[model samples]
Target: MKQPNILFIMTDQLRWDCLGYAGHPDVKTPYLDTLASRGVVFERAYSACPSCIAARAALHTGMEQAHHGRVGYEDNIPWKYAHTLAGELSAAGYYTQCVGKMHVHPLRNYLGFHNVELHDGYLHSARYSDIPYQESQFVADDYFYWLKQELGTAADVTETGLDCNSYLSRPWIREERFHPTNWVTDRSIDFLRRRDPGRPFFLMASYLRPHPPFDAPSHYFDMYRSMTLRPPFVGDWESTEELKRYGRIFDSRTGPADPELIRQAQIGYYACITHLDHQIGRLIMALIEHKLYDNTVILFTSDHGEELCDHHMFRKSRPYEGSCHIPLFLCAGKEALETFCPSSSCRGLIELRDIMPTLLEIAGADIPDSVDGTSFLPLVYNPQGTPRTWLHGEHSYAEHSNHWIVTQTDKYIWYTQTGKEQYFRLDEDPHELCDEIHNPVYQERICLLRNHLIDCLKNRPEGFVEKGRLSAGKSYPPTLSNA
Candidate 1:
C-alpha cells in the first residue's frame, strides 16, 4: 500500500468553540463543519502552554513545554530540537513543505521541512530597529515580498491602522486575493500542482488569520456584523475595577469595557474565521480536483485559542478555557480512516504535543525517542481510552504567569506571581463562569490536581516547587537554559 499524503492545516489563535460544528451559534464554518463530520474530533484538545512560541514548540517537537524548553511567548529563541515532525516524515521518504507561519528564530529556520514559504505575520521582534536587515520580516517573508511586488514597496499589512495584538478591527482594504489567508491557500494549491508525484508528501498549510489585525475581506466581515451574537462570559472572579483599569488602552490585555467595542471585535473575529474556512474549502476542492483527496489524511487545529473578551481578557497566555482550549480534528479517506482513526469523536484529553507522534504514527514513520507525546491513534480507535489522566500547563506572563492542571472535565489554576488559585468544574460550567477553589466540597479533587502540578514542577530551575508545596513570587523566564 502506498503511504498516505498528509495535510496538516494549522490556524493561529482560533478558539475551539468558534466553529459551527462545535455548536457556535454565530460563526458559520460550513467547510470546517463538513471536515469535522468526515472524521474524529478530539473534543478535549488543548494547548498546554497557551502561547504561540511555546505551543508551536510542542507541536513540532512532540514534547511538552518543559521538554521543549519554551514555557511562554518569547521570540528569537533558537529552536534546537533534534527531532521534529517534518524531519521524521522527510526521513521516512516523504517530501515535506510548510507554506506559512513556522515562528522559529532566524525568521528562516526550516525546522526540518525540505523547504518553507515563510510568512510569520506581523512580528514585533522581527521589525525591531537594531535587528539585522536580512533577519527582518519584510526581507524574509515571501508573502510580503510578493505583496510589495504587486503593490509597490510602501504597501504593508498595517495600512488599516490596527495593531496586531489589539482588539481593534477593520476589513481588508485590498483585493480578496491579496489577503494572507488567500495567499496561503494559493501557494498550497500551487504546491499540489508541482509536488514530487512519486513520493508521498507532507504539507503543512499554516495560516495567520484570526490571530489579529482582524482584517478579513468585506463580504466576510459583513456576514456577522449585523447579527446578534453571544456575549462574552464574565466569571464571578472578575473585578469590575480591573476591567475598567485597562479598558481604554487599544491593545489592552484585559480588553475594553465598552460592549459595542467587544461586539465589533467579535464580528471581525468571526469574519476572519469564516474567511479562513472558505480558503480551506478551496484547498479541499483542489485536493479533489487533483485526485489526491482519497489518498490523503487531513488534520486541522489551532496552536492555542483567543480569549475574545472572555472574563474580560482579550489575548492568550491565560489558563482560562478561552485561551488554552483549542479545536482538533482529523479526517481521511475510507481506507485511511479504517487504518488510523475508526471513530467519530474522542473524549480523551489531548495537547499540542500529541500532534507530532500521532501524525508520525499515521505516516508509518518511527516516532523518535526524544518525543514525550503519546500517539493518540489508540484513542481514536477507542474513544473512551485515557491516554493521560491529566495535563500540566503553564506560561510565564509577568504578573499573570500561571501553572495549571486540566483534565477532560475540570481545571485547576495557580497564579505564580500572586499566589492566587482558581478551580473550575468544566463539565458543569463549560464557560468557567464560577470559581470553586475555596469550596470545601471539591478541596480533595483540587488537592489531587495540585499535587500533580507539584510533581511536574518539582525539578524545575525556577524553584516553582519547594518542600512539597508550590513556591510563589519567584521570577521565571520564558525560555529555559537549554533554549
Candidate 2:
C-alpha cells in the first residue's frame, strides 16, 4: 500500500478497560469496539510516567521518560527534541496537524506539526494569576477562548461549580455543540476537508475529556445515570482512609468525601467516556464520507489511565493498573490489516515511547536510532513477538514516587522514597487485589523482578540505585517542578 494517512486519536485519563472491547460492562463505546474488531489490540500497553507532560514527552520523542529528561510530570519545559514523531513524519513528506491538546511548553509550540489547533483543557497551572487566562500566553487556547465566546466571559467551569479534578457529575454548562469534545471532532473533520490532497496526512485528534470535571453532555450523562456503573476495584491491602482524609476537594489525590460522592463521580466519568465515543463515531463517519477511511491507519489510545476512586486514588501518576495501564488499538479500512493479520491481539508489554516508531514503521519511514522504542509492527503477523522482555516505568508524586517493572504475566513495584516492594501475578490477579511481596513462595520471582528494577535505574542521574540496589529516602522531584 502507498503511504497511508494516519488518524491518531488520543484521550486524557482514560482507563484501559473502559471500552466495550476491553471488558467494560457499563460504558458504551460502540465506535471504538468496532474499530478494535478491525484491528490489533495491545493488551499490556502502559504509559511510562502516567502523567500529562512526561507521558507526552515519551510519546513525541519515542524515548523513555528518563531518557526524555522528564521522568516526572513537569510542565513549562520546552520540548527541545532533536527528533519527534510528527517532525520525522513531516520530514518524510507527511503533513502533520494536531487539532487538540499538544500539552507542550510555550503553549503553542508545534514541535513538528505544521499546524496545531490547540485546546489543552483546564490546566490549573495556566489558569491562575501567574499566567492570567487572558494573557498572550493563554490567548491561543482554542477551547477556553471559544467557550467564553459562545457563552460570554462569565462562562467557566466554575459556573458549573465542578472542579477540574473532582469526581462530581454534571452535564456540560452549555449546549453539546459547544463542548470541547465536539469542537475537537469538528476541527478534525474540517482538517480532513482542508488538508492537501497531494500529501499523506498525520492528524492527531487529542481529546481532553474523560479526564476530569466529569462534565459530559446531559444525553451522555443520562445514559449511565440510570444504570449501575461498575464499582472501583479495591484490594484487601489498599486503604480508603487517604481518600476519606482528603475528600471534598478538587484534584485532590484522595477523592470525594464519601461513598455516595464517589459513585456520583463514576457516573460523570462513564458519561464522559460515552460522550467521547460518540464524537469519535462522528469522526469515523467523516472519514468514510471523504473516502479517506480505507487508506488511513486509525490508532486509538490515551495518555494515561485515571484512578477514579480506585484504591482510594483519584488522579494518575501511580504504578497501579488504573494509573499506568491504557488502551491501545489500531484499525484500517477495507481489510487493510490482511497483511498485518486482521482481528488480532498482542500481549507484549507496550509503552508510550513505542507509538512513534510504530507509526513511523506503518508509514514506511526509517526508524531513528535515537528512539528508545522499537516498532511492534512484526507483532501484527506474529502475536507472540515482543519488542522487549519487560517494560520499566516510574513517576514522581511526593511520598508516592515509585518505579515498576512489568512483563506479560507479572509485575514488580518499588516506592522510591520508601523502598517498599510489591509483586503481583497479573495472570492470577488482573485487578491487582493482592500484593504478594511478602509471600515466601514467590521469593525467587521477587529477586528476578527486583534485579530488573535495579538494572533499569542503575544508570539514572538521580542515583535511585547504588551498586545495583535501590536505597530509600531519595528526594524525587514533583511532577510540575522544573526539571
For TM-score, the strongest prediction is 1
List candidate 2 stretches off by more than 4 Å: 132-138, 335-338, 478-483
Cα lDDT listed for each candidate: 0.92, 0.86
Residues 100-139, candidate 1, lDDT per residue (tens digit)?
Answer: 9999998888989999998899999998899899898889
Count of steric clashes across candidates, in order: 0, 1
What are the per-model C-alpha RMSD values against the true structure? 1.0, 1.9
**C-alpha lDDT of residue 415 in model 1:** 93
Candidate 1 has a TM-score of: 0.98
Deviation (Å) of 42 in candidate 2: 1.0
TM-score of 2: 0.96
Could you tell me every candidate's TM-score relative to the true structure?
0.98, 0.96
lDDT of 2 at 271: 90
Which number leads on lDDT? 1
Cα lDDT over the full model 1? 0.92
